[model samples]
Target: MNTTTSPTSTKNLVDTAAANGSFKTFGKAIERAGMSDTLRGAGPFTIFAPTDAAFDKMPAGQLENLFKPENKEELVSLLNYHVVSGRKLVADIGKWEVAKTVNGQSAPIKLADDKVRIDGALVTSADIGSTNGVLHGIDKVNIPTKQ
Candidate 1:
């Protein structure tokens, strides 16, 4: 008898986002923030990934300035603001008014009319599963304010 074990599926959050195509700008930001590896790790993270068009919604020169090499720390913090430490699907998030982020701050969540909002960005899609976590596509990039 011959038996073969199928390869274990292991596409993580970063891989999922990169494969989706709509998240190209967000993927680049993840690279600039040096967070590609972290998002690929285990332990279940929930990321609010903004699409390329969302990044374009920023004020003139803002996204460009944030992407500069000198602003890596700021870029990282901003990116982290969109990430929560656990897998929070739409149903799971329905109970939350605020979700703690990896950045050491909390992001306000608003749920109404079957819509979910994180900080001020509307969640355009939700519960994109990965080996390491889940992702929600947002229409705008969320910026964290100093608390």
Candidate 2:
């Protein structure tokens, strides 16, 4: 598990996800949640990004339904579960049993045998750098327990 990925990309978290290609669904979710500007803004944030394949695992039409304007609140809550307040490296995150997210909920963090898991999503890639923060690619979308 290579956690501390070294990079100097000038793009923000949103742009970094866009360039990753695999994060199309996560990127769109961010936009739909109206968080593109927040993620693009200055100051460090850590994002547990879910890959498009992860979104595919959702119940059929669930993703599309979440995109509807009426459900934006739900979408925002879900997306915010993946975002932390400040930039956190894998080791830093590992110290947190449950990390406080921007959405007011805490995501459970697990580090075992050198692998990292957040809210039941396995981190496939770690420590991707962006201008404002770092991102880790997850194998699943992390839904809050309440939802």
Candidate 3:
């Protein structure tokens, strides 16, 4: 079956993920990182959005610290680790250890036993269609690639 999605249809995916309560933190972080506009834009994007559970795993003050004005760059870097340069699906991302991110850094892609993982985050849901790009829900937030 053909699974390509258009930007208009991404809303349904976002809405569905939200309603399921699995992506609340990811949704909020997207807004906080000021990435809603970019992700919602036209083009194919691969979003490795961290789940609410993932956010809960952070240290007591880490999440709050990341949202501070002083830490915007860090937050941006962290979020950028979740995105790639294009709409890369699991089949297209085999065995690559590094992929360029929107933040001008690289993210590690681990493909083992046909199980593809970006950083340590598994591709829980893939091929989420958006007008500009694609959204893939990830289980964890990937750490930024060091400069």
Total backbone collisions for each predicted model: 0, 0, 9
- lDDT of candidate 1 over 23-138, digit per residue (tens): 99999999988998889987689899998999999999988888899999999999999899887787778679998999999989898887888888888877877888888889
* Overall lDDT per candidate, in order of appearance: 0.84, 0.89, 0.70
TM-score of 2: 0.94
Task: Tell me the alpha-carbon RMSD of every candidate.
Answer: 6.7, 1.3, 3.3
Expressed as tens digits, the lDDT of each residue in 48-128 for candidate 2 is: 999999999999999999999999999999998888988888878877799898889989889888888898898898899
Q: Ten residues in a row with the worst lDDT in model 2?
A: 1-10
Higher-TM-score candidate among 2 and 3?
2
Superposition TM-score, candidate 1 onto the true structure = 0.91
Q: Which order, best to worst by TM-score? A: 2, 1, 3
Among the numbered candidates, top lDDT falls to 2
Error of 2 at 147 (Å): 5.1
**Per-residue lDDT of model 3, residues 9-64, tens digit only:** 63533443455467888777767888776766654567777778788888799888
- Residue 7 deviation, candidate 2, in Å? 4.5
